[model samples]
Target: MKVLHVITGLGVGGAEQQLRLLLRHLPARCEVVTLTHPGPVADGLRADGVPVVHLGMTGNRDLSALPRLTRLVRAGRYDLVHTHLYRACLYGRLAARLAGVRAVVATEHSLGETQTEGRPLTAGVRALYLAGERLGSTTVAVSPTVAARLRRWGVPASRIEVVPNGIDLARFRFDPVRRHRTRRRLGLPDDAFVVGGIGRLVPGKRFDVLVRALARLPGDCRLLLVGGGPDEHVLRREARRAGVADRVLLTGERPGLPDGSPGPDLPSLACAMDVLASPSPEEAFGLAAVEGLASGLPVLYAACPALEDLPPHTAPAARRVPCGDEEFGRALAEVRAAGPGPRTAPEAARHYCITRSAARLMDVYATALARQSLSPAPQGVSSA
Candidate 1:
């Protein structure tokens, strides 16, 4: 089936990373469409030979391209219009409906607590987003926690499906040779325990808290921060103020996408780490933590409801630090002293393999299409 995926932008984030893996590993039949102008992610997708259509969206709520989006969907004769993130979800579904696509589906990537850009006009945007989810043929949440959130917000339980985010185990699995090589290449001390964080340098990610936690840890420990954004300068100054400047190695922002590149050294870099920390208070689903586990390193994260689907072993490996730096520091020290335990590489792979997620999504697509075919069209709805 021809599936066109619409997302806000092709930047490095969990949703964008998931999109790349799905296109790379999904059956040859799937295709993609990104609403925002092509960015770094487009380079990765194009490298993998996936077609990405750029909508050239300049501002939020840019309905100017709605007609063009409709034309594109109609021209492609897409079987399904699947969207990720809020803006694309809204615009993708509306365009699909206008183009008479068979099914319009949207994946709720994040809880929508923080904003990268764009301002909502009023309370109506939230209402409209909820309404859009309801009107769409199916709504997919990355985890059961998100699905529950949708139901709590009044989306019919029948309409919401839980399809967890997945990672490419092959790309992220532990590689011993690469581990030593990556550690050496990055110039990290072999004796020092490294705590790595990969995320957009945003307030929600709480890099400042990580810096504070590092302040409390011994001088021997080091923090490696990857990715760059609005929070870079603030976080740099935070490290200086915390008096942990020497202990922190801020890469500012590395190339490729979140979870690092699909490079030879990426897996090693992950596996070489003693611990990977995610201090975000509101994680919908953790791709980095899973990748860390897959790489044979322990993970530490702030307690978040969406993490319920992660395997019990992951939680055991992960020290659930509180939202504050003091608590985080204490927890980090404990985990680092003990060191990462037996590698649960196989277990992690089983839980988050992209191939498994693709098969599951295919099932969702097939089930939704079968139901739509068997049932009569809505009062005003039409088929592809």
Candidate 2:
């Protein structure tokens, strides 16, 4: 079937990268439209031979985007319209309905107790979300944690589908040669205790805790932050203030999957690291932590429903720590003292392979199409 995916933007964020990965594995013919910021991920998607169109949405309240998107949807004659992220869900749902595509599915990629995709949750957000939700056939949550959050926001449980974000396990597998090459390219010493913190460098991510934790560790302990954001300078200043600036390396946003970007991809960086630490107090699925697990790196996370939802025995190398500097610092030290054990991916990684997620998503798509066939179109929504 022909499918169209609409998203808020195509930046190197978790949701954007997740969409890119999903498009590669989904069986149907798929195209994408990004409202704004067609960045690295967009280029990667194109390289992977997917058609990507930028909708040029100015801001949050751009009403003009709705009609434009509607026209595009109608012209495509898509069998299904899948929307990702918050802004896309709101606009894509309405546009799909206006364009007469009843088989619409929206994925809740980021939903926390206090935020939705890093934006503060307000009364208006809830109202608009619910309003848009009604226009779609189904809402797919990345994890049970996000599904619970959606239910708490008054969305019916029957409408929420749990399809966790997935990873290409082969790409993230540990390789000693790759580890050495990546470390040399990034100027990391062979024996350095590399502590990785992968994600947007935002306040909510609490990466500053890692900087402080670095200060408490030996000089050889390095903090390599994988992604970029507005908080880069803030984290730099924190590193300087904490006297770990020399030890912290921020490789601005890298590709989530290996799409032949210039420098070492995230998988290589993962192999170079000794441990992965996520200090973020709230997370939707904890994708970074799972990627670390795939790379066979010991993971320390403040919040990871992906791991927590699984049986504890599945991920023996992963541990949870509070999002405080001292607490994370102690965890880091404890990991370092133990030395790097065998770098082997745990059973948890296999549970989140991209193929499994793609199969499950196809099921969601088929079910959505079936439901749309049985239900009557909204009053004025003609099958144009």
* Predictions in order: lDDT: 0.75, 0.91
Cα error of candidate 2 at position 170, Å: 0.4
> What's the residue-level lDDT of 216 in candidate 1?
91
* Local lDDT at 70 for model 2: 96
| Candidate 2 per-residue C-alpha lDDT over 179-282 given as tens digits, one digit per residue, 9 for 90 to 100 | 99999999999999999999988889999999999999998899999999999999999999999899999999765345443222788989999999999999
Cα distance off (Å), candidate 2, residue 177 = 0.6
Name the lDDT value of residue 374 in candidate 2.
83
Residue pair clashes in candidate 1: none
lDDT of 1 by residue, 208-252 (tens): 988999989888888988776788889889999999887777665
C-alpha displacement of 343 in model 2, angstroms?
0.8
